[model samples]
Target: MIYSPPRQANFFMIFSHGNGCDIGTMDTFMKILSDELNTHILIFEYPSYGLCQGSVDINKTTVNNHAERAYSFVHETLHWPTDKILMYGHSIGTGPACHIASTKPIGGLILQSPYTSIQNVITGLIGFPGYLFGNSYWNNLETMKYINCPTLFIHGERDGLIPSEHSKTLYNSLGHIENKQIILLPDDDHNSISYTMSSSCVKSFLKQFFPPSNQLLPEINIDPEFRVPPETIQTSSSIFSYNPFTSLFNLSTVSINATQSVYNSMFSNQYNNQ
Candidate 1:
């Protein structure tokens, strides 16, 4: 495990890396997240990946066991609050992250290049039926229904290996979450998202829970190419909607005053692509 400490961290982020990436390759990305959010981070190597012992275990059961162990190391052993810990998963790491979130209480979740399920990704990639892999990561779609925390979805539009559609599907499934955001980078591919994209939008999502002090950073202008999708904000009578064709982040004219029936219809129509 690698720990990067900040003077006054809002929370400790438990980060999971994608396939073929261990803690070493993720060092630079860890530094970037830490610097952007002013938070401590813990990144660990998977079994048999990098310098770890034994064989690689990508099965959902084994992966969930590993995630529980890490959670215990920090929350049980070190005595961190369950509500203050955030789980972040990239690519295959989303499997374990979603598993832990379904079983544990967490402040938030961040899924980068997430998929509805590995089987769905496989089906999309090779045109094979998902049922052929019956015992596979069966139901992230089902697990997501139980996770109601604030969430963020990040993906690259040009990701050839796992298309951005995966993230869109995952985002649409987050019906229980009151606050959520999605960012689609136009120019970035699977591997380049970490370095090519700006962390400003990520920090924006984190700040609602961890408010900054007097020392505020100046707002950085985001490049027009990186498209940040509409975020959902809860209100007394209705939910705020995202307008894709707008200049500002939150446009009032597109505000959706949804009754229960209208909300369902609006949400279904807005995310119909999934």
Candidate 2:
């Protein structure tokens, strides 16, 4: 569902979804944003969600895989710097978005209706430790600690799945990469946060976070006519195939199943080569 415009621009809007959600659920927001920003938006899927399958014990949708894959695609294939991208997360999307901002050189990041951790929320709800629960997804708190980009945190005050306090916890953790802002709506719930997403203030948000420069195009001032959703996007082809940034670091050829030992070595090599 991520629409790629023909010519590559410096700025890319990357959307990461929650556990069971697919890029389809996020298309409306991205299209609206594209029309406003006059550019393309790439929304990614979590494993076992939407078109993505072949389950990994750890959710492919987790911060570890999703963040690094997209980051590699942009830096290696597109041959762009982190300064040319914006990381956007919603609900569970908050995990990868925050992780990318911490590891990638991004212009900014956005988190909507985010949670501190699923484990934390479950413990609060069930009066038991989250780690004691069979599936513990309450680890995003640790990732939020490293975010270094300008960030926008938007949470519905009346959310059911997660509370605005989660966003507050994250805002307090960031040390002002450029600017960090949080918006709370009076009667909004987790899903209803999308309604406020279409608000006119998005123009200002884009202006501030993903600024318009001769460097990157601004969102088109007009809204887009809702288009029929496509069945799939071809992701195998490289979009940034010609860039030399990737050549210098040699990071893309690594395997999908490598252990942390193999993966950490690449970063170490990159550090030594630099």
The estimated TM-scores of all candidates read 0.73, 0.70
- lDDT tens string, model 1, 130-243? 466564463666778988788888898998767898888888888767688888989877768754253565787787645544543222232433212212221211101111
- Quote model 1's TM-score: 0.73
Per-residue lDDT tens digits of candidate 2, residues 1-274?
4554445444677777654345666566666676665445667665545555553433423545766887776666656556767777777677777777776778778787777776676544433445644443435668766777777888788875577888888778776455788888877877776533543444456676665566644442212422345454423312112321111111222321243345467678999999
Q: Which ten contiguous residues of candidate 1 have the minimum total lDDT?
A: 234-243
Candidate 1: residue 81 lDDT (0-100):
75
Against the reference, the lDDT scores of all candidates come to: 0.66, 0.60
* Pairs that clash in candidate 2: 36-219, 36-220, 37-218, 37-219, 37-220, 38-219, 38-220, 77-240, 78-240, 82-105
By summed lDDT, which 10 consecutive residues of candidate 2 come out lowest?
Answer: 244-253
RMSD of 1: 16.5
lDDT score at residue 166, model 1, on the 0-100 scale: 82
Q: Which one wins on lDDT?
A: 1
- Cα TM-score of candidate 2: 0.70
Angstrom error of the Cα, residue 129, model 2: value is: 1.8
